[model samples]
Target: MSAAFAHGLIVGKFYPPHAGHHHLIDTAAARCARVSVVVTASTAESIPLALRAAWLREAHPQAEVTIAPVVDDVEIDYADPEIWSAHVTVFRHALALAHGGAPEIDAVFSSEEYGPELAHRFGAAHVGVDPDRGRFPVSGTMVRRDPASCWRWLSPAVRGHLARRVAVVGAESSGTTTLARDLAAHYAARGGPWAATRWVPEYGRTYCEEKLALARRRAKATGLPKPWLDDLEWESPEFATIAERQLLWEDAAARTGSPLLVCDTDALSTSLWHERYLGVASAVHPRARHDLWIHTSVEDVPFEQDGWRDGEAVRHRMDARFREELALRGLPHLVVSGPPHARLERAVEAVDALITQGWAFAAPL
Candidate 1:
C-alpha cells in the first residue's frame, strides 16, 4: 500500500522517552514513508539533549532522530503560542539542515493538543496518536515525578536514568559478596516493571588478590617464604585507587540500562579498612553514595580464615568500625543478620521498600 505521507514530523522534549513517545513515533513511522523525530531540551533541563536524541535514534532506527539546538532565554512551555512559534522555527531550520533543503513535512504526528496548530504552521496535516493516552496511559510528567511507580512506561534508556544503587557492605566474612550476588539474582529473576538488575563485585578484593599474586612471584624469585596478606600493609593510596576503580565499574554497569545495581562493597567500606590497617581514615576517596545500604552482620556468618582475611578479632573490630562510621556519617543502612537465606530475605525486603518508596534523590554521582 502507498504511504499516507511522504514525510512526517514528531517532536517532543522526551524529557526521558517513555512508551507513549515510542507509540507516537511508531504510529508515525507506520503511516509515513519517512519520519523525522526532533528531540528538544532547554538549559534548565538536567537530562542532556544529545542523550535523548541518541535514545530516540536507538529506539527507532527507521526514523531520522535529530537534536534541536537550545535557544537561549526562550521559554519551552508549548501552551504559549509565542513559545510554540519559536520552537517551530527552530525545528523547521533543524529539519531543513537534516534534509539538506527546505524539507517538506506532509504531516505532524503527536499525542498532544498542539499537534493541529503545529501542523497548520508547517502546512501539514495533523495526525494525533492516542491523544487521550489510552494506549500508553503515561506521560513524561508522571515518569519524572515517580519513576519507580511509572517504571512500566519507561524505556531501557529512561530506566538507566532512574536506576537506584544499593551497596552491600560490612566487615570481612560478613557475607557481603554473597548477599550482593543473591540480591542481583533476585531482581533479575523478578524482571521489572523496571529494568534488569546488575551486580558490581568488590574491586578491593580483586586488587588485593593481584597484589598477593605479585608478592608470590617476588618470593618465588628469591626462593623465600611466600608473603602473607598481613605482611603487606594497606596504604591510603591503594584504598583510594580501589575506590576510584569501584566507582568506575559501578557507573559502567549503571549505564547498561539496569534499574537496580547491587554493589558488593563501596568506597565507604574501603575507608573503614583503610582506618583499620593504616590507622588513619583519609577522606581522599570519593564517598560512594547509594540509595540503600545493606550491612551484613558478621556474627552468624562463620569467619573463614582466607589467606587474605584478617583474623576473627580484626573482623569484630572492623564490624564495630562499620557501625560507628555509618552512624557518625548519618547514612541510612539496614543490618542483615541471621543465616545466609534469612539475610538475603532481609536485604530483599529493604531493597523492595526503597524501590516502592519511589526515587526522590538525585542520580548517583
Candidate 2:
C-alpha cells in the first residue's frame, strides 16, 4: 500500500503533548509515507521543547515519524508578519536539521487556519485533520489549566513528569517501607488512574546487603571468620552511588505508574547517611524533585534487627538529622508519629490534601 504524500509535516507547541496532538500526528502518519512532527516551545514555557518531543516519540514508537524540537520565542500573532517569519524560520531550521537538508514537503498537516499558508510557503498541499477539535476535545491550554481533569489524555511518559511525588524518609526500622507500600496501596484501591500507582523501595538497603555479602566471600577465601554487616567500610562515593540509583528507580516507576508515586527513601536521605558515617557533608546532591516528604517517627516503632542494623542509638541520631535537614532546606514535609496505622492515616491525609490542591502550571505563551 502506498501513501498519498511522500513527506508530511506537522508542527505545534505541544506544551504538554495531549491526546489531540497525538491524534493529529496519527492522522498524518496514516496518509503520508513519512511524517515529521516538529515540536516548538519558548523559554517562557514550563515544559522544555526536547522533553515534549521525547514524549511524542515515546507515544508514537510504532509510527514512521521523526520528532524534531525547536525553540521559538517569538510571540504568536497572526496579524504580525514579523512574528510569523521568525516562527517559520525556526520551523524550517528544525526540518532541515532533521532531514540533513531542505527536503521537499509533499503535504502540511495541521488543525489551525494557517495550514494553507504554511503549505503554500513549502510548495505542498494543505491537509487539515480536525480543525474543530471534535475527535479529541482537548488542547494544551485545557491540559495546563487542570492536568488532573485531562489526565487520561496524557501518555505515561508525560504523566510521570507531572505526577505528584511523595518521598517517605526516616531512620532504619522506622516503618518507612511499610508506609510507602501502604500509601501506594491506598491509592491503587481507588482504581482508574490510581490502579497503576507504584512505590519505590529503598536501594541503599540492597546495596548494603550486597556489600556485606562480598565482604563475607572475601573473608571465607582468606580462611577468616564470616564478616558481619558492621565489618563493611563506608565511603563517601558509595553514598553518591546509592543516591543516583535510588533516583533512577524512582524515575522508572514514575514513567510506568499512576499520577502518584510513593518513594521509600530518596537521594536527600543518602546525604544524611553519608554525614552519619563520614562525619562530613556528602557531595551527593538530589537530582530528582519531590513534591512532598513524609518523615516517619521512631517513637513507638521497635528496632527490628534484620541482621543489618546500626542499633537504636544510630536510628535516633539519623531520625533527628532528618528532622533538622528537612526544616533547614525549607522543603514541604510533615512528620507522622505514633503507631503504624495512625502514621499511615496522617500520611494519607497529607497526600489527599496535596492532590486536592492540584498541580499549578505556569501560563504558556
Candidate 3:
C-alpha cells in the first residue's frame, strides 16, 4: 500500500454504486488513510443520497466512506437559470465546508465535471480513472437520463433491494424460450407473481424490424432522404440500446413489488453481443458486480432460427467471450452447463439461491 494520506473525499451522485464506480472507489481507498464519499442529492428523487451512503457503507465497510448532506439545494433542470448559480455555488460551499472542518482530506477522488476545480479550490489533489483508455463513462447525467430500467448498471447490493426481479440468460438454444416460460409457470404454481422475457420474444429480429420501422418513420417525419436515414438506422442496431432497454426493465421490476419477473439477458451477458456487434470493450454491468450472474451453456441441444441465427462459430465465440469477460471482471456468477433438463435444473437452483438470499435479507426486517 502507498503511504496513507490524512484524508480523501470521493464526491458523486452515485445514483447507485455501479461496478465501475465501486472499482474507482476501491482504488481510491487503497491510496488514502480514510475515504469520505460525499454524494450529491442532485435531483428531488435521485436515488436517495442516504441510500447511496448506505450502499457505500455496505460495499466498503473497511473504508471510511462518509455521506455528506445535500448542501446544494437543486433539481434536475439544468436549463433553468437558478440551477447554474445555485448548483455550482452550493457544491463549492459544500466542498469548502467539508475541507474547512477538522480531519481535512489531502486529496479527493472523482470522475466528475468539477473534479479538477474542486481539487484546485480545496487545495487538494484530484484523481481520475479511465477504464478504456480515457473513455471514461463518468457521466452520471447519462445514467440519470437513462430510462428507469437502466438501473441494471447499478451494483447488486442495490439491485437486491428490488422486489420484482427477473433474469433470462442461457447459452445458444438451450431452450431459453421454454425455460423462461417454465420458470414463470413454476413461480405461479408456487403462488408467486410471474415474470417473462418478452422484450424481443427472440432477440435481434424484432429489434431489426423496429429499427427499420423507425428509420422509415423518421424519414417521413423529417422529409429526409429515405435511404440515408434507413442506413443510419441500420448501423444503430447496437448492444447499448438493448442493454439500455433491459435497464428499464430493472426499474419496473424494482418498483412492482412482484415476487418474480423473467428477463432475457442483462448487460453483463448482453456485453458479449455488444462486443460482437459493436466492437466495444466489454465491462460487467454494475448490477453484475454483486448481483447473481447466470451463464448458460447447455450446448448439443438443437438451435433455433428465430431470424437471428448465425453460424455456430459465431455463437460459440460470443458465448465464450461473455464467460471470459465475466471471469476477468471478477463478478459473482454461475456457469450452468449440461443437457436441457439439467441446465434448467441448474437455473432453478440458481434462482432458488437468489430467492433464498432475498428472503434472508428480509429476515432482518
Best by TM-score: 2
Candidate 2: tens digits of C-alpha lDDT, residues 87-148: 88888999999989987899999998899888877789999888999988889889888777
lDDT of each: 0.80, 0.89, 0.59
Q: What digit string (tens of lDDT, one per residue) describes model 1 on residues 1-365?
A: 88899989887888778999999888888888888887767667777777887777778777444434333335657668888787788787767767767778899998888789999989999998999999788988877777766777777666656689998989989998899988888888876543367799999889999998998899999998989887775667888999999998887777674668889989888888788888888678685558888888897988897767888998998888888878887888988899989999988888888878875533311
Error of 1 at 168 (Å): 1.3
What TM-score, to 2 decimals, does candidate 3 have? 0.47
Reference-based lDDT, residue 257, model 1: 43
Better lDDT candidate (1, 3): 1
Each candidate's number of clashing pairs is 0, 0, 8
Best by lDDT: 2
lDDT of candidate model 1 versus the reference: 0.80
RMSD to the hidden true structure, all candidates: 5.1, 2.3, 17.7
lDDT of residue 29 for candidate 2: 91
In terms of lDDT, the poorest run of 10 residues in model 3 is 356-365
Q: How many clashes in candidate 1?
A: 0
